[model samples]
Target: MSRDDKGTISVRLVNEALLAFTSAALPAEQLLHQLGLVSVDLTDTDARIDVADFSKLWRRLARHFDDEFFGMNARRMRAGSFAFVCRAAMAQQTLDGALRVALDFFGLTFEGFRGELSRSESLAEITLSETSNVPPLRAFSYFTFWMLLHGLACWLVGRRIPLLAVELRCDEPDYTDDYRVMFSRNLRFARPTTRIIFAAEVLDLPVRRSEQELHSFLAHAPSNILVKYRDTTSLASRIKAQLREVPAEQWPTSEALAQTLCVSGSTLRRRLADAGQTYQAIKDQVRQEMATLWLADASITYAEIAERLGFADVSSFYKAFRKWSGTNPGQYRSLILRADEPIASRFP
Candidate 1:
């Protein structure tokens, strides 16, 4: 991990970790100490943590439960329990078939949970249901299952699955905005059941991975699933991609980005709202990412970087950078470039 890996993660990341420990009652101070995330403001919805530290926090919380499902308000899934299911999935010929195997395995293994698939001519749905035997699913647990299944489906098909929407039975949480980073913006809460929707056409896609790839994929396990999608269909992803395609004179305005997608400003704003972002928020994310890479080049002046990111002037860019990283570009540059690079990764 580089300095880039040092989050300023969404505070929801910590709250999600709490999902894995929902059944336990650990002292908050002791829990933070174990995770080395004492600096984290647990109550601050706007807070962020170093990515490396967040991973540590996750490991600490998960270990306490000794259950991979993280006590998801249902059953405690034993660590390494998913491997057998993956092995069964690899024996199938198609994604649909693999999913059937996974569904069967989960149904047999988990007492209060179920994995189901329902399809029509143009749409497909994978629903996760909870019976009365176990506690209700937490929002974090539901999100994890969605990510895990979605990630595996993509990896198995050697392509991304652009989800149309995600349905959650739980009420919206304090970290509603963070959901944008996880899934497509068309999220619906208070749904009858939890499910992910996509095109039915992908049902027949052949499984592309082999046992060797499966081994590597399993090494990361559930953590590997929590990744941002680069789908060409995703609004945020498309916005980021378009921001890179245009001239660097200044970043695109809300109207410009909306025009690129062949949508009205109101429509664009409505879509982004579902993903928990504003146009300016998307611009900030894109600009900060590009700016960080540009700033790493000491040969380039800050003014030049500002121009490249579409800032009217260097001052505005500097102010935006502070909001993104909590420090000025100069300070961030020093932390990132590291005059003498070390051999070790910032992550454990």
Candidate 2:
């Protein structure tokens, strides 16, 4: 779509996704025409489509296929990104050892996003963030990258530990059903950020694929695969989750938490210091997270969530949610739920 009408999905991911969908059978021209575009300009990586015409193209394609065009794009990106991650992971001796390789080398295959990986005694979270200006497709691309990471990790281990949770920063409707079908997990919408949360134990799963096999696969890997995690994780996700459980007024202080963890306040400060986190950092995280969650839940009154979150009132809550997610809670929830319904149903 035109950059103005709606953001175009990542060109690289979109290309790779489309390639996988056609099994490399569809020609470039045919694919563009199918999307209802008169032509394509691949020379410029950030390609544009006629947004006004997208619906027509999408509908025409939908008539011939049972699945939605966007869904097909999601599936294709998932497979291609999965293959790229598996190959990278196979290059390392241990799952933990290979994380850097997975993060750094992913760029060689995919573009348009970055990721950050962190480890704790109980959990390891890989936060995926969109780096492109293409809002329309960036969220989908980010989701595809996340699905690839989770899906391939499970596939490579020959077992599914599943994610502890999948969080999307976008304030869209409940695509939880589609997300569940794709990632096989509980999905949270209007989260402060996008992430795939899993028990650290999953990182211990052995890599079964051989390097030679991995090398062969990478040789033909598409150019659209994404490779690095951003610095979005740190304390943001944890803080946000904690906010959901604790009221803003009652939120724990960094010192109080340090005592609970049986450490000195200074020590607690030092740890978070090392990680580039702080009490205020956590507070902001919680605020953003709760705002998103409250917005997504149609059952929850805005005023109730606002009071719980320690906002002054409904208007304050509304202003904050808008600032965090870019859209009011109502609009975000509607978009996500509608987009995700078909995908979610597939799992059932």
Candidate 3:
């Protein structure tokens, strides 16, 4: 899917939902009209939907069943379930604290299931540690809960926390053409457990929300959450994610990267400019990170690292490295080696 398509969702996400409603013998046509749907077939898995439309449909369903989970189970997860969690979460002073509260909220309310908070030196992760069987939570439950926490986490911190990756126990579904939209950062499927990986900095981000803000936030409920968190990525960062997939010896040019994201050169530049970022700055950052990793090896020659990082010559690489690190690559490597930090430690 193209970048702009990130804001829309595949109808596949709604197929199970529509079927569940249809099986219950709801008048499908009337229901579709009520939800502002244009199409007659609610089961069109290939059709795409604007997230706003999807959110409206979701709210209608939630109110109809009085279950936020849309009868995914016998339990009625009342309409206020999300609001109550938000109220509790808003009290926390930091994203870390708020995340814990949200997780515990799910654990206590969604019995038999367990969730966890963990961290590596560079990542803060949340995972569903156990599954429930009392009535069994469906796979969609896992994603909803994960997204709730991720979205709320972003809301709490007042910034996108850079959700780096997602791991799912189920295989990639047919409806995920939209997943590549804004969520193209990283998506993994058929993993052992459902998980969301966040950049470690998220742990320390302070909760910028307040009681006043909570009111506006709660007023929107799941709609605000359903919308993809777009601010989490900059054009440069998006490019960097793509760069990792390419051969390090060369990186995509600005025009090429813009084309890859399906935007024009001017549009990309204008958007990046709006974000106070420049393409060159992003390119340099990607190059720096790659160079640091190569230099950490201690086997690759400086010239080879230079060549691979796309430098015109060893001297140019030296100049750029010095500008980036305030020290030569060798010294940066030695410092990290002495400190016993990985190459990634070179950057914040």
Candidate 4:
């Protein structure tokens, strides 16, 4: 559940996301197959989809529909709408100014819903409200809006603007665990309004990304925005980074890792438990991320990937990959290769 482990998204989340397509009477099953996901994947409540594929789904829908918001709003968010917003915000002097500019753009662009930024003495808030015409947005749409705004705010200031808490109006959905990892763990569902609360001082942080960096950033688009900008200060992120410096076979035992971090094994377990993570989960996440990254390279054989990931054999790797991504590694690779413009190549 660590943010650093943006390797897979829950099947529950995928279902919630598909609600948009279903509501619009779009062909959801065909889209799933195009992304190498089968009906069986949706049937498993515990299954997960590779994050890259999920991003592809986002872009595919956006381009074909010409609505970046996935037709969730009455007014279409035209293709390249987000890019224009980014450009407008990039000229602002501070995070506060940048956020206001972006929020204003969204306010004018979308017909029914608008984002507003306000602050009390100690805390700042970004609240989303339905103004007039459109139907109330689903919980998934609200969260997706927050993700884009929050992610962009972090990138603008070149830091993770920690959320004090998140207030959602809709009832908490089944994939609450994913929400905990994506936003703050201190989520309040069935609240009066849907807004993100954070410390006011972040408003003063300078907008640090330059025009040149913005080009590359936009090139990656929604995929980069989805997986990047996680709060890396978490203990899990630090330990995951430590694990990545060596082959997975050489990763330390839980007790040994705790000792290195200058804590007792019991304390380490307790701390990670508080964060909804476990030692084995972290290891699996690291392995899963590496597996997908390596699979992007056609030269790497299944046996080689297995050996490198510290798997005993190819069969074991296949089982673990299936568990992690809900698809075999070969099928995953085929999906990537089949993408009209593969997301893997974009990263390279």
Candidate 5:
């Protein structure tokens, strides 16, 4: 996907996430530099970080501190804690039971703070509270915990669980739009507590994932956890998912896609416009994401990639890729293939 796509994280968030490293006097600069970030990238207040690199930063921090909680709690949540929790939770019969297992594990891993699960007739909630003199948790801590819990829950149930609402105890941050995109749009800040509410019926959803499925999921690690489970029920997301199922060469026109979705062409256009999207933009995004993924495979040639992505020719693919990423395909491929090389050698 393009760097400006939904798969990117705001620099404000990147800075906030690095606070733990900064406070601990660790080598945040070295880590970011190794991950292809520079002084200008971090100094630019308006810049963003690619989601893939951000995920890599997360894994690096966990390894460096031996604390997956990012030093937010007095207790160190050891590196393998999440993996262990996932394995244990997998044996549960339902999402409600699975979440209880996860909450219990985290409760045992950390100190002072606790997570509680409750349900009304129609809604279920996960609430967090601190019981001791532990330092006050930041908004990032709460949101990160939610991402883990919610992401695991969705994986266990084999689908995205739409959050009905989210209540945060801290004041709103500048990255609220990112939160809206990641979790729910109906967010409330400075509330009495921090909790996520969802449909109570989701509690009974059977654990549909197998051990093999989970092994594959864990292989991608904390990075996939960040971007894979965002709300996919939007009209745009639904369309994108549908298009991804078929080859790009077979992708339908806007009118045909509208007919397939059981709406008139005008209604389809109007709804997508209302959602701040266009048919052509969605198509471009699909091609962009596919092109990037394909570029990572050494066996795929440029001519073959262009044909697979439905470009008329190699030159046309080059032009479209440059438009999407601001760099030509060859340069992008060099950067991707040499990601482990020195920073100076990897860029430009």
Candidate 6:
């Protein structure tokens, strides 16, 4: 397909791919015809399509086959402009250079989407903002775009896997199994916005693609993909974000936390206890998750990790690592390093 014509791969392709593994399925031509009538004029395989046209078709198709349409849309819709820019950036010699490329060119890729790669304390958040009226499709499109970006980054770094957590702004449903399968994480639904949370350390992974390879990829990068809506924050999501900010080392005592949250200490404790967790427990859980990512790298030493985590000393770091992982830092690092070697070897 021509670059402009290659909007997003249609849901027809995905459905066909899935049907390949099953028997007694819909015919490919029939499926394609139905998708075409609902979406773009697929009969003219080379026809160009933009976000507005795609969104209209998606809304129509969604009404007829909400589940299938949303599923396929979630898988295919991506940040086409961002993808092109990222591919170009990957051609640069260093990660820093590539990041500069993203910063400089991201605006040129998508007109409405706003993105910021910013540092908050020690954490670097790559935030993407999408303002659209159709919240579900928009959220799904952004979710898919983030997944593609994450997947592409892993592919470049030679770590072809998903991130730690994929947070979605959509409502809770039985989509957990599919979300986990796609994102490889603790999937959170009914949140404020769609986000893929990973360690900032991932940005340090070395770029493997050469300038020529990147040029080739960008030369044919798909650019006419549709945009979808992402919704605003809900009350529960606001609470979750507030709790997320209280990392283990920074978590206050129950009374202190309750006061900070503007509630009585006993009430706060009782609420969390009823949810089957305590404030301390959630803080530890978040810390443990963060620690796992940090420990996976060989370059970071135990002392440095302890200091970063606000631990008292190496002994404390070791103890906590063992408690969280059931293994010492040395053993955990060894296992990760060994797993990493094969990935590195493939890229090399």
Q: Pick the candidate with the highest TM-score.
A: 3
Q: Candidate 6: lDDT of 4?
A: 29
Give the TM-score (vs. native) of candidate 3. 0.70
> What digit string (tens of lDDT, one per residue) describes model 6 on residues 85-142?
6677678665545655765564444444445554333233454554554454333445
lDDT of 3 by residue, 1-348 (tens): 444454466677766556556645556666677666665365575567877777777778888768776666545668888888888887877778888888887777764455788765555567665543233345566666666777777777776554445666667665554443334335656655566654556677777777888888877755676663653344655676788777765677889888989999999989988877888887776676677667646778889988888778999998997776455666655533332322121111
What is the RMSD, in Å, between candidate 3 and the native fold over all Cα? 8.2
lDDT of 2 by residue, 19-57 (tens): 433535777557777666666554456654432233344
- Which 10 successive residues of model 6 have the least lDDT summed? 224-233
Q: How far is 140's C-alpha from truth in model 6 (Å)? A: 3.3
Number of the candidate with higher TM-score, 1 or 2: 1
Better of 1 and 4 by lDDT: 4
Model 5: residues >4 Å from true position, as ranges? Answer: 1-3, 23-27, 34-40, 132-136, 232-348
lDDT per residue, candidate 5, 245-314, as tens digits?
A: 9999899999999999999999999999887789999888778767766775679999999999999999
Regions of model 1 farther than 4 Å from truth: 1-8, 19-25, 35-39, 50-56, 132-136, 221-223, 228-348
> Candidate 6, which segments miss by more than 4 Å at Cα?
1-29, 33-83, 96-107, 132-139, 160-162, 211-348
Q: After superposition, how far is residue 17 of candidate 3 from its true place, in Å?
A: 3.5
Task: Give the alpha carbon lDDT tens digit for every residue of 1-348 in model 1.
Answer: 112322245776676776444435665555676656666667776666754565566555556666656566445666565677777887888999988888887677666667788774455677776664334566777876766567677777877676655767678765655464556555666656667766667879998777898898876644455543332225776676677666656566788777878999999999998877787877676676677667656899999998888788989999987776445777656643442343221112
**Clash counts for all predictions:** 5, 27, 0, 0, 0, 3
Q: Is candidate 5 or candidate 6 better by TM-score?
A: 5
Candidate 4 or 3, higher lDDT: 4
For each candidate in turn, the TM-score is 0.60, 0.39, 0.70, 0.64, 0.65, 0.41
